[model samples]
Target: MTTGIAARIADRIRHSGPVSVAAFMTEAMFDPREGYYATKNPIGAGEDFITAPSVSQMFGELIGLWCAQVWMDMGQPARFHLVELGPGTGQMMSDMVRAGRAVPGFLDAARITLIEASAALKMVQGRTLTPMGVEALWLDRLEDVPDGPAIIVGNEFLDCLAVRQAVKQDGHWHERMVGLDDDEDFTFVMGPRLGMDADLVPARLQDAPDGTLVEFRPGDRQLVDVLGRRFSDHPGRALFIDYGPAQSEPGDTFQALRGHEKTDPLAAPGTADLTARVDFEQLGALARAGGLDVDGPVEQGRWLKSLGLEMRAAALIRSAPEKKSVIARQVMRLTEPDQMGELFKVMTFSTPGLPKAPGFAPEA
Candidate 1:
């Protein structure tokens, strides 16, 4: 018996020729009835996969401090938007808010906003955040965020945005699509040639050898455009921490995770989490083109260390000496080169003229 999402997708593919990978992903991940996020909480232990914020409280606390510092750099706006995109379980924001207490007036000055589409997750977030004595405004889209100076934070969020993949064939790029196979199961198929525009394939991989697969997220570009316009009208800074290469490269990184194990992305739609590697270089370029200042796509481990991850861990251990081993393991998992440390990266974008964000080097 096919899953609800799988059956729906099969029907669509049967009626239409083929759907772009991005379209397939969007439907699988966002379909109201059975989409992954729509039906379940997919973060934390025993979930599909664990995010950094779930790994330890330190991650969220450090991020909170970073935002507080940025708020100070913004000259302490009387009332500025402190927005979080795709706040998973509200753990990061909770930790951030807790840490923000370190800086007087930071919490008072913050107008907390969470941009989330999943109603189920929103309920979960409500439970997580409500007890902290912090009231938050929840919206379904970024455009709905009220106009004002803002500091946006997204952790492990960008990877969830759908991406379209193209394969180089005979020196031309063909859009990779999801189509029903002979058995009516989902499968990858090559679609129409991109011709002149090359379907917006990044220049860096335009001339890649035949058979190279390049992925691009139109959503990312659109998101940057929206943020750029928002920042242009007001002052804002945004931080995105995710796993992706610091430089753009051509490859197929589309994948799925279920119960912390890698699974076939096209096997069962809407039942597993689907994601692709973020292209930080391309993202930075888009932000720059949108007239925003971009900061390092620094390794997450280095960025966290620069923000004093070790110091924070030590403090936490000193407070709970009995949990020293557990705390040490969390730090190693978060910052060790072979672990999440090197694979994940941190980047910031701000309206031009603001001081550089914390942990990032001064502009040359």
Candidate 2:
């Protein structure tokens, strides 16, 4: 069945021309009728990957405290938005609200909003968060949330948004595309770069030699700009935790996973998880244009340590001896540079008055 899907797209390209990698990824990851995120849970043991918040409670707790700071920084707005994007199983949010109680008056002043697209995961989230005293309203887009002072968190969110790819050829960058091959299998091709993209390619990429493909996400930047502009009208901050970097570099970061195994991305359009590394630098630029104070694209390990995750973990371990192994593994996943620690980056954008956003070096 997977082979048939790949073959169909591939054959289209063979007869036609190259399709942008973005077009292919969109179909592969979100065809709705049969897409990766559309059809699969893609988390926990049965899935291709696990997210940081899922690995430990400490992660979500710290973020909870971070939001509290945003509230405090804003002089504790009587009503504010505590929003979480793509909240999975609602575990992180539950942990967040629990930890945030430490902040005096935080719970009373905030409304929890979650943007989730999966009915299956939403049910899981409902079950997990129902016990918490807080009410969580679910939505399909952040825009649905009303305008207000907000502290938003997006865990492993931006990476999954569709991205476009370009490869340097003859000192000219061409957009890499997907199309059908002779067997109707998905195939790669190059298209003439059009629109404002020619002006947007990184300066380093402009002169690169042939055969080098660069992945990018206009959708992400557009989303970032929207969120930034939305918050621009009010006072608040946004924190993004995902796999990427503080700076832009060249490489194809796209991949597919099926039951924790690497697979042909195009082979099973609806079965495998499809994702790529986020481009935080691009996000930063878009946010700035929309009028926001952008903070570090800091490494996740560094950010967690700066937030004192170690102390938090040690406290949890002391409280319960039976959970030692679980605590240890969670610590490793959040702090080990090779795991999600270093590879996953954390960044926040804020309005003018936000005190230096927690978990990173203050911007000069």
lDDT of 2 by residue, 150-234 (tens): 8889998888788888887777777877765566556566788555786666554556667877777878767777777887688
Candidate 1 lDDT, 192-278, residue by residue in tens? 997764847886877899999999899999999999999999999999999999888998999999999999999888889999999
Using TM-score, give the best candidate's number.
1
Model 1 scores a TM of 0.98
Over 4 Å off in model 2, which ranges?
Answer: 1-17, 362-364
lDDT of each: 0.92, 0.80
Q: TM-scores of the models, in the given order?
A: 0.98, 0.93
TM-score of candidate 2 relative to the true fold = 0.93
